[model samples]
Target: MLMVALCGAVAGFVLLGHSWLQLLIAGALGIIFTQFAFLAHEAAHRQIFAKGTTNDRYGRILGTAFVGISYSWWMNKHSRHHANPNRVGKDPDIEGEALAFYEEKAVPRTGLRAIIARKQGYLFFPMLILEGLNLHYASVKSLVTRSEKPTKGRFVEIGMLAGRFALYLGAVFWVLPVGMAFAFLGVQLAIFGLYMGASFAPNHKGMPIIPAEVKLDFFSRQVRTSRNIAGRFWPTVLMGGLNYQVEHHLFPSMARPHLARARLLVRQHCQDHDVPYTEVSLASSYGTVVSYLNRVGLAARDPFACPVASQLGRR
Candidate 1:
């Protein structure tokens, strides 16, 4: 991990100064940044170390300094998402502050939002094009304006994030021609965004939503609400061990190396308890997500298609 980060930084510094290499470097840099992001994610979950603070150190350094995201902000938000996976009011993932991932979140929409809500399934992948920038913006905001009780390292994190971007922006603007710099920056951020979302959305996007009032046991809730991508090799490596979503949710701190084995045991446990275990190919999982979104989208305009409405009627 250190070696990868080092190589990325060294190569990025060298290439950023060369106008001719900016385009190629931008694409490679995006992948490198994403790899750091995956490692930072592991650190956030305490998977990289036995001690919590030690892991936080790794997370703060890797996520902020390298990925230009505030670790404290991410940790706080992600912790909530874990505690209440898809719980309607509690899970930030479906809160739809910017984009509506669920039916309830789409209500009260107007004009452009309403139009987009109707075609959200088609726009899901496209929207992820900006996720990288969105995450960075949110992370910085969380520190300056949004933190409840600011974590210990938040101020330092702010500095690191700002400094990281300063160097990145400075290099691109100073070293390359104006048009090429924009192209380089755009490509890097776009790939970073798409890679970030594509790798995680399939894990739980179309899974069962847990209503706010419903109570569930830990194991059952995690299994029922999460979907696992079934494969080895590329799936395991590409997803940064997150393709084992059920196991990761169940044991979020378990090392990435152990998730494959844990998945087998967790699957068997779910079977023993008759819990639903949804595992599908990566492509199929996306299909399920699109279908699910389209169903909810249609529900917005057609009462007959609203599953929630049908349930309310029975009551």
Candidate 2:
């Protein structure tokens, strides 16, 4: 992780003197930031260390300083996700603030929001261009407003986030003209958001949304709600072990290297128990997510196509 961060920094520094072509470097750095975020995620899950404090120390540094994300905020949200993946009202990921992930959420929209809700599936990827900004905003918001009682961790993360932006933005402006620097940053943020969304969305966006009142055993809950992307080497490296999301959710602290073996074991166990397990190619997973979102969006459009309307008539 340290090596990757150092290499990214050196590469960015070397290319800063270039003209608008430096936007390429910005895009590459965005990828590097996503990679660092993956590592920070593992650290937050305790997959990198035995000691809790040790994991947090490295996670904070990697997430805040290198990736410019708030570790504490991510930890709080992600912990709930792991605990209750698709559970309604529990999983923060599905409580879409900008885009609706389920039918009921979409059905309540009005005006322009209603129009957007009806076509949200198609807009999802393009809208991800703003996700980088959204993530940064959410991180800062969580730290500043959500921290009911301020702690040392909050202060430390605030400082790290401030320092990260200062150094990163300072270097870009120092090397390029104002307009060029803004364009470079724009490219970087767009790529970062797109890549980050692509990798994480496939894990559970299309999976079953467990109603808040429903309950299931741990194994069933995790396996049923998670989708694994098919592949071993490249997928693991690309998604940072998130490709094996079933195993990761089942064994939150499992190291990235062991997810393959764990996947085999978990698959066999699920088969023996007659529990469903979903695994699909990366492209196919994206298709399913888009289709699922569009189907849910039906609730905001034609009543005949809306499942909620059907249910109401049945009642």
Off by over 4 Å in 2: 1-9, 15-18, 149-152, 302-315
Candidate 1 regions exceeding 4 Å error are: 5-21, 146-148, 302-315
- Cα lDDT tens digits, model 1, 277-298, are 8889999999988888766665
- Give a tens-digit lDDT track for model 2, residues 1-315: 646666876676666575767888778888888999999999999999999899999999999998889998899889999999999999999996788888889888777887788778898899999999999998888778855556449989999999999998998888888998899999999999999999999999989999999999998899999999999999998898999999999999999999999999999999998999999999999999888888887678644455666559852
TM-score of each: 0.91, 0.93
For model 1 the local lDDT of residue 141 reads 80
Q: Which ten residues in a row have the lowest lDDT in candidate 2?
A: 302-311
Model 2, TM vs. native: 0.93
C-alpha RMSD (angstroms) for model 1: 4.4
For each candidate, the alpha-carbon lDDT, in order, equals: 0.83, 0.89
List the pairs of residues colliding in candidate 1.
none
